[model samples]
Target: MSSPRRRADLFLDPADDPREGGPSLGDERATLTEFLRYQRLTLELKCSGLDAVALARRSVEPSTMSLLGLVRHMADVERGWFRRVMAGQDAPPYYRTDTDPDGDFDGAVPDPAVVADAWEVWRAECAFADRFVAGAPSLDVTGDDRGELTSLREVLVHMIEEYARHNGHADLLRERIDGRIGQ
Candidate 1:
């Protein structure tokens, strides 16, 4: 009998080849925003149509890199850089601490409620970042922290990088989960 399809195979469209087109940007701000938006969409695409166990399944050994963990981590990262670092707030880290650095992944499980919570937090953070970026003049603006400066450009770029890195992990994890591969 045919094996179950891998989660990665289901998310990434292997039929679509990577393009070699030149970059398109009307301005730096627009370009950065677009890139960030694309990455976020890619992440969503990866997690789409997944059940609680599928989203939280650990495909690799000795690692806890589930799709749900990625969502939680991204949520924490968004709040950290935008709300805490950029806005200079005193909020605590989400789903992690010094004692449990891997809490986010460790806490990830095949629970429908947890999956819903992760998505909710991630969507809210995305909205917050979008609003902040829309009203900002430049990515190079400084926060209240002395010697600390950030631009909407830099944050967006970093977020893209972050998503790309995790997506790589997702690719393998998904592949292992079902043997689907390509995109």
Candidate 2:
């Protein structure tokens, strides 16, 4: 039997380059979409070619900043913001965190199946967010709750910022894992 594929391979699909055949950064739709796309691409680039252990490896002491953790965290963020906050839906978090707030990272392990599940969930959440945003009204759209008014533009910008912050962490983690750099 062929040896089992690495866990990180499940999350990192370098075959799908986010920058492939896309408009130049200066082109329209390059404002929010481009930044978000680049952030996602950077995350995947940071994760590529790592084994399960490497993906889940914690380089810094007392910090569980693994690529796997980032995947799980992003999944939760997507669901929280787009599904719950934006749509006003009540849903439980993607990962359990009653005992430890850092359960997302703490629970991540060097397992191929677990990695696969994380990627699947993250991709699904991304798709859901995309669909919602595509059909969503103007950025000035307001929720039923008057206090929750926010433009879709603001949410998209916030999402990009979120990815930017985590991608920075991913850069360092990936470098520590395999000396790879430069998006």
Candidate 3:
């Protein structure tokens, strides 16, 4: 029997990723925020042009991750960090619960409405995160993350890291769905 197709074989050249204007070098705050924004856009770009069926496809056998699930998970991440932790607002999770911890991935059904709602919630959470960052007095501002003290800079950096990692998964997922890969 022939070997299964490898997703890694489908990667487009790294240079093919759409280049965003690099963050400003002079200002520290501007650099952090711009980099975070670029990472966020990268995730969006990876998911663009995909349909519900493609978005809901899991990765190779063991992992249940899907592009739609990533979007949903990120929405909850943004809300959890910015609204619930940083802002100290009592915001409920968008897709997960204590009992159904994997709801984001498990609930990613292949339907147009589900796809649309995933994007909607993701965008809303991103907007809210932007507002929270913009309104903060300074990067040094601290938040209580369940007993640990965290700063705005820490959260922003964490967010950038989070998006970067997930976007890599998105790259593979998109390529697996369609031989299209890259930025």
Residue lDDT tens for model 2, 1-183: 899954332233457566555556553334666677777777777787777888899869988779999998898888877887778887556775677777678877899887888888889888888877767655656443236676667777889999999988887788778766546
Candidate numbers sorted by lDDT from highest down: 3, 1, 2
Model 1 ranges off by over 4 Å: 1-23, 144-147
What is the alpha-carbon lDDT for the whole of candidate 1?
Answer: 0.77
Q: Each prediction's TM-score against the native?
A: 0.82, 0.81, 0.88
TM-score winner between candidates 2 and 3 = 3
Q: Comparing candidate 1 with candidate 3, which one achieves the higher TM-score? A: 3
Error of 2 at 134 (Å): 0.7
In candidate 3, what are the lDDT values of residues 125-155, reduced to their tens digit? 8899889888888999998999999999999
Assess each prediction's global lDDT (C-alpha) against the native.
Answer: 0.77, 0.76, 0.87
* Cα-lDDT of candidate 2: 0.76
